[model samples]
Target: MTITTLNGVTLAYDDIAPPGGAQRTVLLLHGFASNRAEGWKRTGWYTAFERRGTRVIALDQRGHGESVKSHDPADYGRQNLAADALALLDHLGVGRCDVFGYSMGTRTAMQLALDAPDRVSNLVLGGVGGKLFDPPRPGAAEAMAQAMGTDDPETIENDFLKSFRHFADEQGEDRKALAASSAAVSPPLDRAALGRLPMPVLVVAGARDDLAGDPAELAAVFPYGKGKSLPGCDHFSAIPHGALKAAVLDFLDGIPDEDDFPPFE
Candidate 1:
């Protein structure tokens, strides 16, 4: 793990280097509340990228993992998060790289491309779409808020377990940090800005995603983006193991086809 100061905040990240000949670099961002370790490492994404001779860097976004955490949810806004990520790349002396993000991380990547198109060579978004900001499901925000306000650790633990036990359990090393961070990044994303991003994109969602938009609607938002729904899966299940691997590989490789293109207006 490496730590760096980006925009006055300390960020934690991991860099994995493949053997011998490495061709390209990829920056992997995990979802809200999850750190880079569980997002990429435990999921075998790092290993997969490594085997393909790609150098992958995974970041623990502000308020998650080992990075800085804040009680203020406003600090986790998309614009601020995006700048922090770009600064991390600059600090590492990386000119540009492929960006892959899942869930909340996916939203961050999309915003990054919009903010610094020149630095993003390719974009891959998983488990989210532009529709999330269109007023959350009835009572959903209230529900999460109520759960978060509980002073009882048992209740908080139960809600967290129900919401993400599979991934949360795997994140034993940074569970508390991640939980705090996820809380900060929450309330989902703001959709109005997402609809206008023109970056070349790849949007992947689970076929049965309970929280995201339908594939067709999601694909329509980007003039150059395509949508792929993993077969027989839901939001979280869509990303584990085989379901997401091939789609990600295909998307990354396809970026070269649009290497010289400009974002659609």
Candidate 2:
């Protein structure tokens, strides 16, 4: 674990190199309330990338993991979160690299690619899809915020929100910080901006992931984008699925045919 102060907040990250040094680099951004360990290492992502001889860098986003936590909603804006990633890259002296993001991290990855195109070579977005362009469901964010803020778990009526609250509690995260982040402002998705990205993009989601909508629709927005749906997986289950890792490895390696990949059991 490495500690760095960026934008007045301390951030925690891991930088692991392959046995014989790395031929390429990949940056990983985790999901909401998930740290690098829970999101990537524990999921076998670090080893997968290392086996490919790629340098792996994964960060715990602000208000999550070992990074400094803040209860101020103003501190959790989308742009600010993306900026922290950019600062980390600059601090590490990495010029360009591939990026993989899951769930909330996908939004940050998109912002980075849009704001710093030259720095990101390719992008892999998991657990997110066409819903990126949709306006926030009415009160969805508020419900999640409430769920995180409440002391009594039974009060959270929404199953989805309740699940998040339970996960936060299990992780022993700062609920107030999470609540602020949930309520933070997010940038409006711009299809025109996404279409302009020249680098290849991959979107992956579970077939049963209602939160992500259709992955193919989101992929169509990018000129060089492709989408893959995991069988019998939902948003959370899709994260650690072997098929998801295989798809990402194939995409990053520039494999032309996804059809040859075996179906997930």
Looking at model 2, report the run of 10 residues with the lowest lDDT sum: 255-264
Model 1 global lDDT (CA atoms, 0 to 1): 0.72
lDDT by residue for model 1 (27-125), tens? 988886578877788778888899889988888887778888676656777778888889888888888899998887877887788777788887888
Residue 2, model 1: Cα distance from true site in angstroms: 0.9
lDDT score, candidate 1, position 35? 83
TM-score, model 1 to reference: 0.81
lDDT of 2: 0.91
Output the worst ten-in-a-row residue range by lDDT, candidate 1: 173-182
The best candidate by TM-score is: 2
Segments in model 2 whose C-alpha atoms lie over 4 Å from true places: 259-265
Model 2: residue 53 alpha-carbon error in angstroms: 0.8
List of clashing residue pairs for candidate 1 = 33-182, 63-181
